[model samples]
Target chain A: MTRIGRRGAGLMAAAGLVAVVGVTVVRPQFSAAEAERPAQVSVDEVEELERAEQILIQRCIERAGFQYMIVPRFVDPVPFTFSYVVDDAGWADKHGYGAALRRRAEAKVDPNERYFRSLPPTRQEALATALNGPEPVGLTATLPGGQVVQHSDKGCQSEAQRELYGDLPTWYASTKVIQNLKGHRFGMVLGDPRYQAALPAWSECMRDRGYRFTSPDAARSEKLTQVVELRQAGAEARCAISTGLGALVRELDTSYDAQLREEHQSLLATRVDLQRRALPKARAL
Target chain B: MRFMKKAVAAGAILVAAMGGAVVSPTSASAAVTAPPPDGHLYAWLDINAGEYYHCRWVGNDDNWTNCTDWDGVARNMHDRASSVQNRGYTKEVNLYNDAGQRGAWRCLSRGEFWPDLRNVRFNRGSSETGYNYPMENRISSHLWVSSC
Candidate 1:
């Protein structure tokens, strides 16, 4: 109804809300169905332990790409949440010190998920075995309809999960659990009751390479402006930023980059200019 | 990587959300020097006149050009099989669908033509970037020249 600047208005998206009916008209019993729906099926005590170990192993592989265990962190740019995969070893080596980490969630898996408590040590071991070397193994959890959803410990990237489940919450938990365990066990630390023990070891590894580690939560917070600047200055800080609530970053993702290049060619040039100009001026310690 | 491809898909969805015509892939003809008086001479290559009108094409140079009709209203929304500079406005613009058949359409942006010298000289596609590509060829008839 209202207009703003020429192109800016065109680019703008409507934000303010108006009251609207819930989708009850389309799916009348939506809330009821949710209540009646079967909770996520928990695996057998034997299977739970294997899955946990598998999760750790997968994290190790993911961290190998980063040169060591790096935290998968969340980045937001409106519309979606993004997990920025960073190279921990590269950052530590380049910065010659660990960057300050923020606080992280104590539990990787959601407390309310069906299998959180049911994960037995044996199942955790099976998971570890599946993740240690190659090929993805499928684990099935039976749902309410006598239907089973097959989940792979390895083939689960953020995007894949998004496609399969469509619901953001499921994708978030499953992906974080998978990426977290793999990262911890393979490159940085082993999954143990003393898993938190790995934090100090991580600090030492980062310290040896020159990073200053702190709380994982702070590392994922809005305080990244300075760290981003350091990264742009070529420090490549080891981003152990935990995957805080996975949604996708709407604008900063690759899709936006291509669109800017194609539909809005000039903006591509502008972004390049901004990165070039601002990056060099950023201070790196 | 799959992440990058999905990102590209998301970008296209965004373009659809924004309502700007995504550039179609096709070959655009070169600019024709003289636009006939009766026929509307569309400026393809950016010029002072066309730039004044906020008309430009996106996508590969081959397929698309975002332009307005003679009156500065968006009339023909079509792929640039040949750019306006090459072939002046046809009486009836042809539209094509994915099946490559002519399709019915409606023009998107239509307002009274405001032919401003300042607006003409500095026409940037996206306001964020003030990029101006001058239209080389001029309409030989309507001479609004400034005697400096």
Candidate 2:
């Protein structure tokens, strides 16, 4: 299925290209199932929000008599990175370890970075302050780790987020907590007894396949030529699926993620609601 | 600033005595002797990598104050870093505003380098009423993990 799905509509509408005279608009095509899919914040929606944020930031910088270049966000070709194990044989066969994809991503030059570097030291400092604020003074979110973080409420970046999200401090707090939960969740998943119990079968499956790796993570870490790496990755994925390691990992991941979500339900709900409310504003921008 | 420069200079001489090459930070094409690149998370006392005074760790460090540089000299890097670089092989590095990887934190993806931490902020605060603080000279701990 195409990744854009129903969410493509938001991005298309936000493009505001329908009024451009004599322009051929290539619409994003998706299957019926995709169109009927449940509504969630898709990548396209996030991109739309980011686009709007850039616009707001540009305006803010311009208001401060500084030139601001709106750099397009870098989109990775292989979006889904297999952190725990390579469980998809098809993906492994096509893009083993995603080395080529990484190279392409690295090769892409960011004009905003170049422009910032080209400026004089004094101008660079001024531009940096204009974009990120002179100091992080306002808006703090206490994360789950019991640490306090602060950001500048007066900066263009903060101002843009405030305009889009409505409640800057809450949004900042919620998003930060949500983002930081991954590591904790992963730790929980990996430490689960069930996950440990399933590893032996997975290891045996790999051993039968002529790979001596004790775990999927070990197999993934071993560097080899493109040909060998692809073969090994494919074998690992096959073993993972055959031994039910893949399914178990997914289940544990979901379980741990749900627990984390439950722990921070209020924050997550607030963040989601804010983002949902910002959709129209983002599109309007 | 002058005192810091002098301190760094003195530290460099000590490092030189201990069989490490110290490169001037301002010298064009200055290549300081660094730790072996084995998926290390590096932080600098000054922006753009303070060649003379920097710390590299391959694993989680709960306290930056007790951490030593590649030259094996204690620099009390706690709350004194202005830049950071993540050369992690397959994981992202998390920088924390407080010790023991507590408090507000931010993730630095593999191969990502923040030459100036002034532009970065810890993701959250210790309390709902607390404010997000600037990352510059405020990082006290770090952890390397599978992902951010």
Candidate 3:
């Protein structure tokens, strides 16, 4: 998984690639069984929708009298796709923060310098406005903790989203609500009584293997040599499985997702519709 | 049982993928800063001496010397955050040099890490509003807003 920089507001994801195999090897839960597979949504659907949105964005550019080439930039960092979950141990271990994945993929990016250079500054500005929206007009959403994030959505991405979800402001607020909840969801699962009951045993298992952290996250946070992190990560993954953290977190995540779907039904319904809408477009493509 | 087998197999594939991809080595430490559990905003700060901290939340601190680690990034969190990891889902976070969202600032989209924000400045907004020089350790207060 590679994430394109969300820069210049108007520019699309222009660089990055994920091996098809990466998806198969992602998320321990999904990889293991076709039968006992817990409830989850396919990121594949999301990716397809993203591609569909790009088609509309390109049309927007053409209408503006500028040539727009489809830039199939992958936005999620390597080893996994999206920011939703980290059930994929391979991705989790290799990407930790997913920064390296971006670093590796960025070197291959070409911001269509040739096309942009062909235009004068005035036209360039127009192109940016056409692709993104008017500059200096951005939106801000404050988190529960009161930290505020200001972002520009005047671009093709924003346009695509609006076309799908109806309006920007309401969609933005609704989505942020779920996102803020997301920040706490995983921590909640790991801290749950069921998950907590397995902690001591998991810690013991790690300690027996010469690791000291009581929690998997702590062990993963250690800044060891890549080799050491990799080696320890393997043991940690096994420990998680043996100690039941793996099974428990997956179950909790699925339950939480279901609960969220019900709690935020209207907004989530819009999202589900967005995914379904992408399938026909995908087939046509 | 079959699921566990599949997970183990996936793990093997990952180990193989990571086998030859060697990253630069850092000194060993018992210190562990688990990334903030998924879903919240986070940034990675690396100090001058190769010491790095993966931080979850940063608050309003007027001065670095006046800060503490547990809540923000410890005291002296002022001008030392050389890098940042933006794991945000929707918003673009602005990194300012000075407290209360003052001084030179830079905005990063979600899932971006400026291994170095030392000399970076604000984009998207007018260039006239941002500092012309590189801003290191000058970030004071920041808020997540609609655009940077």
Query: TM-score per candidate, in order?
Result: 0.15, 0.59, 0.49
Best-to-worst order by DockQ is 2, 3, 1
Instruction: Give the per-residue lDDT of model 3 (tens digit) for B16-134.
Output: 54476631111111111122212223343452112334344432334444544324445455555654544333345666655655554556655333433443433211112244344
i-RMSD of all predictions: 31.9, 14.7, 18.7
**Listed models, DockQ each:** 0.01, 0.04, 0.02
- Over A1-285, each residue of candidate 2 has an lDDT whose tens digit, in order, gives 133444677667545554553235423333454456444478887888989999998999899777777877655465332556778999989877676666566456455545655667556556656666533345555555444444446667778999999999788768766766875666566678998889889989888889887666566544478898888888888987898888888888888888887887777767777887898788766
What is model 1's interface RMSD? 31.9
Candidate 2 regions exceeding 4 Å error are A1-45, A65-72, A79-81, A222-224, B2-106, B109-148
Error of model 3, residue A29, in angstroms? 37
Give per-residue CA lDDT, model 2, range B110-132, as digits (tens): 44445557756664332211125
Residues A1-285 of candidate 3: C-alpha lDDT, one tens digit per residue: 112223323122111212334543444534364335323337786677667777877777787788877766544444321222233457547754454565565444334434754677567556655554542123444434333333346656567766755566555555565565553454456547886677788789889989887666555433466667566766676677777766667777777767766776776665455545445545354
Candidate 1 retains true contacts at a fraction of 0.00
Name the Cα RMSD for model 1: 28.1
lDDT value, residue A109 of candidate 3: 37
In CAPRI terms, model 2 is classed as incorrect
